[model samples]
Target: MIKDKYTYINREISWLQFNARVLQEAEDESVPLIERLRFLGIFSNNLDEFFKVRYATIKRIEEAGKAARSELGGYAASELLEIITQIVIKQQSESLDILNKIHEKLEDENIYIVKEDQIDESQHSFIKNYFIQHVSPALVTIVLSDQVDLPTLKDSAAYLACNMKLLDGKCQYALIEISRTMDRFVVLPKKDNIDYIIMLDDLLRYCLHDIFSIFEYQDITAHMIKITRDGELDFDSDLSKSFIEKISDSVKHRQIGEPIRFVYDKTIDEETLRYFMDKMSIETNDSVIPGGRYHNRRDYMDFPSLGRTDLLYDKISPLPVKGLSLERSIFSTIANKDYLVYTPFHTFSYIVKFLREAALDPKVKSIKITIYRLAQISHVASSLINAAKNGKKVTVAIELQARFDEQANIDYAEQMVSEGINLLFGVRGLKVHSKMCVIEREEEDSIVRYGFISTGNFNESTAKVYTDFTLLTADQRILKDINKVFNFFETNYKIFRYKHIITSPHYTKSRFFKMIDNEIENVKKGKPAFIKIKLNSISSYMMIDKLYEASRAGVKIQMIIRGLCCLVPGVRGMSENIEIISIIDKFLEHTRMLIFCNNDDPKVFISSADWMTRNIENRVEVTCPIYDNDIKQELMDIFEICWNDNVKARILDETQSNIYKKNDLPKVHSQFDTYDYYLKKLQS
Candidate 1:
């Protein structure tokens, strides 16, 4: 390892290490079988995105021939690429091992995932009928014979590369696109209390002759292949177009982005692979991963919840916030005092209830919100439309550049616009990622604004599985600054100053640095100096350096980073005072919280931004201080529970080994413990 005084771990490599921890979840036999499979699917999906975005970016930097070592903070882009490739290869092998073990365990449970050759006569008939009815019409096959240019492969979908031997001694290659229109797992007829599952690819393999019976191929072989393309949005610097139009154009351009990686079955023919490599102009330097016959395991995320509810995690009903009812007017409750909504634990319906109340309440004059991503059939959008239809002014700042969801956001924007809602696409050069909603009420000759700020999206569908914090407050000081942020989105040229809110692209980084500096000063004064932060990612080198400085200054630091942490904690004399842990549990830990011991007068903040560079300087984000005593205590309680977690919490050390926290105390699983903690609160 290269050692330098100020240098730290490379962010990309650290991200791979974080993903390894996720893969470890699959290897843990104590987890439920289906949950373990879902973890593997998550690992696969995460790696696909890492290749598409981070790996692709580094590849571009390497290709540009610039000295990216300094830009990356320690290692060159070329070196990082090699490191990533090695780490990913190891993790992929581990994933296969875990999958084999899971398969064995599944057999013990009387469920079998069978291949094409293992099918019985009954299964054969069932699969044949299933394929012809469901999979055949959606299958698009292309014959490769040097007469046609290679087809443009989709990044999100997988293809079956077929090698066929005809009766005339001629060899041919063909492609079969896996149909996303159909489910990836096909459940077969049960025999003798034994359940059987077959991959959609194998089902296609079983019926391949029927699919190509008209072509008269005697021998055939099908291998799965998947391509990952660069997902960067390339927007033209055209002055005539609006920002929304540029984002739309960039979204379209992303469909044909350069291929970054090609993953194929290990048993694929060398000749066919070479033909594909030559046609696609893919050099050996590009990632060409060899794997099992099935690719795109992300589809397993939807793996047929299949009436086997007993085999999955018991569904927990999201509880209502204590003393906050959906039937009553949400505005009236907020008008009385500030409230907090902890999601997945507390129902996300309060947000919807707030909007619904605004839609019908005559005293409410206007509603405004900044939306990053909304659900497919969003009640949020419906409520906004209802407000607009009821003659209440509704303004929505909808981000049309939420990656992979750009089309959905664009559709929502158009629908809202047609419904007389004042829809603002987003800022010119920045994504509006902050989740904030404001309702202006015409109460007693003065307009009062009531709303909430969150650390996650306004998406109700995701709220069930994502752990996030949302604060509902009628505090005018914070809402006034929120209004300023909306104004910044509208005007784009006005320079707004905020005192109570930390707005990004201008204030987030500097303000956070100042907070760290304050902690450093407190340490020097012999006062209680400590900092606790919880975020999704901590990849920004500058922020990491600030924390390192604080660690050197004798200020205790505790971090609960759920993903992509670049700082290596517990290094003697470098970061000995700092401890870092990551929790991967049932719900995605998405809340961003920061607590600083300002000489025992603690300051707590809930933010929509992580410590990553993208969140601090490139996107629009907000970090609001928690002022209410009850809410501050609630946030602290949740953070402390996560911090004390020995189960499911992994230490982030320099080795990137993802070692679980070991102690002699009784086991405490944070996610379940947190749910019970809130349940007790409701009872009391």
Candidate 2:
């Protein structure tokens, strides 16, 4: 239970709880064995990023001598830092236990994850040959000494710290960086129909003598250590450099950013640990977590399948949208009515098809879209280039500061510029986070507009795993508003009024508040009033307060939040009418949808904005109203499917205990049921 003094959960604490839910998936017996290992990878990866970004921010706040109590959800900056460290240590220990259990289970299935010490004579030749051919060339080793200052470690990169006692009683220290390019899991030749896998770390450990063959040392030992540096990009006021150049420079500087978290193998010698800590100047108050034998467990995300389909989740074929054909003229069909494309269930080809159609269509004159993060080899970028080659005036407003994707976006931006496509770097202050597209086609003596607005990125790779809604429509009202957004991108000084869609940096907060107020008034008038919301996260206290006010006014609110939520629900006389659950399943729950009971008429919206502070007041985001009756109902149906999920959904409350939602109702695995729901729609 929350203390009576506070009305909200700390966002950082809530985020840790969310990661705990992910860890729970790894612990779940029902989850497939290999997939459970992958969940451990995800958990480790999430914690690494949390330390790099969120925890680093709090450290900065504390260093700047600011209490930041309200900003940190009522906890002092120093207090929150200590709390986060304790929670992370506990989680790291739990993850290591889970990893051990998974290894045992894998062994049960005849898949032995062999250690360096367990290498047999038959495997010896293969390991030696593999290291010489593959690992030897890419291996980067640094010799550490008192005379030379230790080089700054790359952020989140794992290293094997070496301590060697020489024959003369003197010691030599060295560091060996784990290569990111090589595969972390090396599959050995199978025998007796049994599979064998060795981790790159253990492989290095086995080859340590070879790595240090030149050193005349009596005894040598290596332990894994990793450093997570602050990830915030800092730009200098250089008047001559372009935005892309500045971002590129800042990204390079991030390699040596202030260290926030230092994770080392618990069994490392005290002398070695102390020497490195003194060299790196890591303060005592900084987050120094003692972990298991291996660091950078994020590599387990790519744990070799080894043809073990039985040990992994069954892969489902992506279904096609009922009436939408990839070969047909998407423009012709969507021009008449809006069609909703929910990804992972519905194929993402519809999005590529829309762009491909716009590229080849002779009548199309211009195309405008917002680009955030694109796939490594994006077909979306190729299609946009093809459109530009066809003489269609293509304007792309790609965000350069999309957080960790700055370099990828910069590369694509330069390529687009060379192709003669007009590019907008977005508004000077705001990040253009809206995912939308508009195409103007000269048809029947009047220009007709067709477009799509999505709650996720236009990247096809993420589209396969992230559940997002894309409304493909030729609704002139909505398209006109989309055009205004592009215009805002080019000329940001003038804020345009959007009649059909709510936009951020100026209108989202107030507009959402007005809608919540309407719900409050409706409940007072004895009209059907409720609010159903699905989002990746909600940290905006302003938005949470509005919901709390509506709840106090007797409005029923059901929320499906996939990540951190600050609002403390189920509190009497405060938020008793509010209930929230987080669903973490096979596909990431990323669709941001809102359904307001506007006197039973219902107002539905699909948005590129979450209820986070940045999405509301800092970034350029869009919340496009769902006007098509069928599409709106389809979204509502999916929301209900997720809300009714009893298997993966975790109830959110003051206690931060991620208890799975269960009941006597028939079992509903929402992710699977959602796929089935679409399949049945096609059958119907």
Candidate 3:
């Protein structure tokens, strides 16, 4: 085990490395073309959030002092900040190269991403009319020289930094916020079987002269720029206002949060950049990222499908569970045995079907659920409302502080309350992060509870792209404890105990450490000992140290983490037994699974928590055991497949270089293989 003073990599830097793997997907020639483009969008979107949250927090620490570095674990905040900036700059350059290659490939298929100068006469007229009819009303232009306070710039909105040269040989600047209310891509009329699409920015650039014609400007130039602000919200402990009002005020505060980044076109004049920065009070070190002609590459996530089905991968229909049907009562089937639903591979509708049945069943008495993130148009909320309308007591614990999702959750809470459902606005200080639902129904003489515990959110829209596992069971002990969690949410003063479930802010961290200790003891006894964990991240120093102890005790460790793994694997004598690989492919690996070799009688758990500090000590999370024989074997099989993947898996090492695992054996893409594995099970 090679142990040094620096025992772990910084979490923020590790996260950036994970995103580089996503960029690799865009560069891989074997990937489907359109899928590659979408990966680029995913990479860009991930970076945006990293800046808004993680980077912003680190910058704050840097400004505080060197004393804050001790609290950050090992690396100084200033040092980490410099590393992140350098790494992001390199990744951005790589992304530009990948984009150029993708464009060349697109031209081979007769598809073109054109700018304003490339548009023909017919396309020009089409874009002009389209802009006037659809985009004009939403456009708001601020004349920069005359504004009292530079209009509060939005977090992710793109803007055009207009520089107008008047007939008097004087220069002035104006700002136009891109109309996100309208589509960002405008498809033009195809000519000679070639398809052309223009960006929203370019379309505006084409009509710049027309927009400022009233001002008698001789020369007009518009360059794209975007500002990313710190999204953290500060709430006052007034005691007079309700939680709802506090959250609303926080949302308003988010709009005016300090600017953390100012990205603009490099081609813009120095005077223009300085003008905007001065008004926003932005310092030089505050991420003044200069880029291409367009900003907000995240808009590419909605790039038009173009109706060229051949250019994209065929959409796979979510398969039905082998024995469960939508028409049947889900509770009765779950009562027979535990069943697992693997989403996108297995239909997410099974969850909805279970709730719907409970709503209309005459014997059902009450329903309790905890929602952290929800779909925009949620069927889950609708089912709860229907149950409430049917006279069943329904209670919902909604986390109104879910980042970027506060507004939607507040809306759902209000609507659910109006429908006579009992609504709880989470715990006072901790955000409830568990994805669980319980329904109580009377059977003969006793009330029986049936529910689902999941490793992901209840949002159906994300279920299609995020690979997760939901276990539907009628286990008495687990459901009884789930009820306790819901009770804790409703009555914050009350404390609850659990024998089977591991819950955060109380027992989760201690429980996991105990499990790791057991593995260490088993290894000391000269018995078979191994640990396997699959999660989104692993950054908590305490947990990392525990894993290191187990590694030194001769316990073999295998990890399949999809994002932000701070522990350096494969270090001699220190972590030589630990092998870590991350897979970034068609679907996000979001399921949190942990397996321990309990002297050959293995133990497995599916959890909503990762091994991060926030999940263990700051948030409310749940981790449940897999007891059913069939389900345990299924999870083991999935984990093994992911661990063996060489195609998309990247090694996590000390240098933080994201290198794909290479072998001479036949290539195995775990996602495609997992799909095939499930399909075969259905056939059997």
**Which candidate leads the pack in TM-score?**
2
lDDT of 1 by residue, 446-543 (tens): 99999999999999999999998999989999999999999998888887999899998899988988989999999999989999999999978778
Model 3 residue 78 CA deviation (Å) reads 2.3
Reference-based TM-score of each model? 0.97, 0.99, 0.98
Q: Which ten residues in a row have the lowest lDDT in candidate 2?
A: 1-10
Instruction: List the candidate numbers ranked by lDDT, top first.
Output: 2, 3, 1
Pairs clashing within candidate 2: none
* Clash pairs for candidate 1: none
Residue 645 C-alpha lDDT in model 1: 96
Cα deviation of 679, candidate 2, in Å: 0.9
Determine which window of 10 residues in candidate 1 has minimal summed lDDT. 1-10
Q: Which runs in model 1 stand beyond 4 Å of their true positions? A: 1-6, 237-242
Distance (Å) between predicted and true CA of 477, model 3?
Answer: 1.4
Residue 499, model 2, lDDT: 93
Alpha-carbon runs more than 4 Å astray in model 3? 1-5
Off by over 4 Å in 2: 1-5
lDDT of 3 at 527: 88
Candidate 3 local distance difference test against the native: 0.87
Q: What is each predicted model's overall lDDT from 0 to 1? A: 0.87, 0.93, 0.87
